[model samples]
Structure formats: structure tokens, C-alpha cells
Target: MTKLRIGIVGCGSITKYRHAPEYAHNDAVEIVAFCDPNVERATLMAEEYGGKVYADYLEMFHNEELDAVSVCTPNLYHAPISIAAARAGFHVLCEKPMAASEADALRMIAAAKDSGVILMVGHNQRLMPAHQKAKEVLLVGDLGKVLTFRTAFGHPGPESWSADGKESWFFQKDIAIVGAMGDLGVHKADLIRWLLDDEVVEISAFVETLHKEDTEVDDNAICIMRMGKGSIGTLTASWTYYKGEDNSTLLYCENGVIKIGTDPVDQVIVERTDGTIDKYDVGAMSTNTGQTHSGVIDSFIYSILTNTPPAITGEDGMKSLKVILAALESAASKTLVSIH
Candidate 1:
């Protein structure tokens, strides 16, 4: 079997903990190159992963022959790097908040289409066992119509998770674009959209830098969203969740409610209007403190090997990004923003 050659851009905490290890575990992939502006980081990854290090992604693209590339850089670099990789004929698995803007995301989609390569977004929330189970339960129609929902993704901030710690690009408005909203909110947005199989038609939000000091971007955000299917919900993303991580979602339906990521033993809980409850111990969710296999890398590789559309396509990414962008607009205008 000719293994898929992989090139990884940005040797940050995500690459270290998620992308690199996941790719390494896959028998179908061979990581061929690593690129980061911080050459030391690239070098360290290369030493473990058996790849050549480059300070520039373009240089890596020029030097190495790769089948796919993971864009793990800060939010601002996603579009440009993914575009370059796609145009170079490499499949892309870009980190969430696909790009700084919707326009850049569309350009990335265009680049991938023109190059005939897959472009997958790293919205691993959709791949979580509990989330998948929840979607399955919804699809079964046993829960009846989903009326209201609430999803949250919060942690102690990226300072503890990023490679640069306190100096991480996550705090920089120029690089991160939106702090908690981009880092955590986008994941919930993507997850909710996928779970409900509906788009957010309208949104109103309060995005502010509430807790973290010295950050140019927001530390917390609360968004009220109305899905196209008429379901209303709230999405919360916060960096001030200093005690522990909270990645949970609740969907209230006519029948009862479905809760996800709430119980450690039972990751997915379903309650019926008849006052009966069921629990699923699929697995634990991946958190900053307790990392689990995200299943994103394997799915990306499956799409490449099978020549199928990625589970999370660039279009899906763009749609999810639009929600966060709309939330930002709603925050700034102090009014409801509608998604077209």
C-alpha cells in the first residue's frame, strides 16, 4: 500500500496533542514535512515524526511531496495556508474557524475545487461519540421535534493549552481574530448545526473581554440563535471557566430532552416525556485536561483514501464560520444579525 504522505503546518499544542499523534497512529499516513515560523517547534516535531522542518509552509510545499496537509496555524493564517496547499494539489484538514472571514473560506473552497483535492475542517465535535449518538437519537424521531437547545464549550483559555502558553497567538486579536468565540464558540456552532441538521437563520450576541487581562480579543461570548427549522437556542463560549472544562449540549424536544457531555459515566442521556430515562456510555469527550481521540484525522484520511467528500467539508466550515461571524456582528451592533 502506498501510504498517504502528510505535511503539517504549525507545531502548536493542537498539532502536538491532536493532529500529529492521530496521524502517526494511522497506518495509512506518513508525515513527510513540518513547517512553523518557530523553527525550533518544527524541528522538535520533525525529530519525533520523521519529517523535514521548514520555517515557511511555502518552502515545505516546494520541498516535500505530500498527499495532504493539516493547517494548524492561528486563525489568521488558515485561509492563505490552506489555499496554498490546495492549489499545490494537497488535501487540506484545516483547524476550525476555517478562516478569518467568510470570503477567505470561500476562496479556500474554490482553491480545493480547482485542484480536485479534499478540504476538511477540524470540527471534531461532530465526531465525538456522544454527539454522534445524540444525532442518531434525533434522527430516530423518538425525541419528537427539537424545540430548544443550549450548547457550551468553555475552558480556562488557551494559555495552558497552546505551545506558547501566555504568549500564544490565541490572545492576539490580529492573529486569533476572535478569542473565545473563535476558539470555542465556532466548535459549538458547527456541532449544533450538524446535530440539528439546520442552519442558524438569526443570531444576537454579547461578546466581550470579561476576564482575561492583556488580551485584545474577547474572553467570553453568549449567543442566542434561531435555527432555520424554528428551533431557538443559546450558545456560550468562555475562557473564564477556570475551574474545569464544560463541553455540553442540551436539546429539548416535544418528547423530552437529550443531554450530551454532561455526565462522565453516561456521555449521552435521553429522557422521555413518560418520565423514563436512558443513558449511553459511549466514551468521554476530549477536553483540555482529558484528551481523547478526536477521530478527525482518521475521518480526513478515510475521505482521501476512499475519494469521498469529507465529513466536515469546507462548505460546512464556511457555514459554521458564518454563525460566529454573525455573532460578532450582533455583538458589535448590539442587535440581531440575520444569516442569509
Candidate 2:
């Protein structure tokens, strides 16, 4: 477990923003290779992150003795790249919206299982300090019972974050698959499932393309989910926030209400039935807002080194993907979809 060798595929905005910088600082990781279809981007990342650049990911995988790889490509490529990495004897840390479809996600899971390599999804919200605390509280039955909840993940649009701006692959439905719902919704799906400690049993949704001109994907989505134990929730993913990012969640229970990433100072706050308030300063999730770290890369490396299971397993990722796909199907058919 001495400085695990790593490779990064698809050197896009996520690589530059989270993976590269985070890996650069981690003492346990050595970024050994970088790959992207764009040679210039791959070369720049290699210069900064101390990795060999390659235009083809398969070539990088063949040449490097990588123990793990981060699949940061478009939604469609997630499955193929992850499956290939798993087969190549490298653990994979794939970005959210694990695949364009559930069938693809299941195939990725099967590949990882068959290859006997770790498969961790980059659902960083579950790694957030506030979120971790919330899960702890809920597991201890402090919330009494999560009867209903509402969570939202939104921002101006990919143009604000994408290196390619509006022309990014994220705007193309053929690649990104489901737009805002795929980009933002899947993260919430994973987080809420973990936080509530429940499975989504049903979904009804409205996945739409209402804003952001010249895009083949949706800009906003509203999904209603019925979870196990009769608990239910609303999930909103949007690229039309226009003003700023809103990655917040509110859980209403029999005894209290939990809020995370909602207020300025109190990052995690609990308000009881008697109006007593408890506030915690657990920091943030990503480096974008105020520089708190995501524990995704760290945990992925730990799992690989220790021969332990990752927090977000391939099956867990598939379950989250199922919710999103079901929502999209529900939107298209105008009916409540049952999660089998």
C-alpha cells in the first residue's frame, strides 16, 4: 500500500477541478498516466499532475501499471471505460450517473464482480461531513422516522463549469443521456438513499428541457420518489438556477427536521419538534465552495489497499441509476413507475 499508482481517463473539468488537485495532494496516490481524446487537455493535465499523456485511454491502460483509474468521461463512456478498467486489473472510481442506462450500469457491475476489482462511484455528497453526520443521526433513530423530505441540486449550467462551456458533451443527449437529471439528479439519488437508509420503491417524474439554449438534453427535472417504510421525497435537479448553486437537502421527521448545506454558518442544523435548534459546522462537500474536501478518492484508495469493500459499491451505483432511469421512463410515459 505504498503510494498506489493511478491513471486518469477523460481529462475534463471534473479532472481539473476535483480529481487531479485532490490526487496531487494525497500522499497515498501517484498519478501515473493521463488520457483524453483531446491531446492538448491530456498534455496539460500530465504537465500539472505528473502523469504521461495519451490520446487513447485503452493505450494508457495497456502501458501503465495502474492500480486504479478515475473515469471522468461523458455519461455514455462511464460504463465502457469502467468495465475496461475493471478487466485490466484496476479498481475504478467512476463519476455519478454511473451509466446512461440501468442495463449499462449492471454490465459495469458484472464486469467489476467478475474481474474481482473495486468499483466505487464518485457520489461525493455522501462523503460530505454534514451528510455523514446526518446519516449517523438517522441511523440512531434521532429523527424518529423520515416521513417526507425534499432535496435539490442545481446550478447555473454546465457552461459555468465545463471547460468546453455550452458546447460540452454534457449538452448532447446522445452522450450525456438525460442532461440535468443525469448530471445532478443521480448524485441526489445516491445521497438521499444513503441518508434515509432506504430503497426507492416507486418514482414519478417530469424530466424536461426547458432552458439553456442549443442543448439536446434536459435542463431541469422533478422526480417524486416513494421509499421503503412508507417514506417519500421530492428530488429537483436543474441547470436553470441562473443565480448560484443550490445543493441542499431537508429531511422532515416525526421528531425533528434536518438541513444540510442550507445556511451560511450552520452547515448542518437540526430543529426539533419543540423548536430547539442544534447547529453544526461540518464544512462543505467540494472544493468549489469554500474548499472542503471530498473523501471519495481517499476511500477508494483505502478500499483498494485494504482489500475492503468501498462505501459506494457497483450494485449501489446501479440502484441509484435505476431510480434515474425509472424517473425518465415515468416522464416519457406519464405514469408512476414501480421500482422492481
Give each model a TM-score: 0.99, 0.97
- Tens digits of lDDT, candidate 1, 18-106: 99999999999999999999999999999998988999999899888999999999999999999999999999999999999999999
Model 2 scores worst on lDDT over the 10 consecutive residues at: 284-293
Identify the leading candidate in terms of lDDT. Answer: 1
The reply for model 1, stretches above 4 Å from the true place, is none
Model 2, 113-198: lDDT tens digits are 99999999998889888889888777888669999999999988888688898789889878888888888998999999999778
lDDT (Cα atoms) of all candidates against the true structure: 0.95, 0.89
Q: Clashes in each model (backbone N, CA, C under 3 Å)?
A: 0, 0
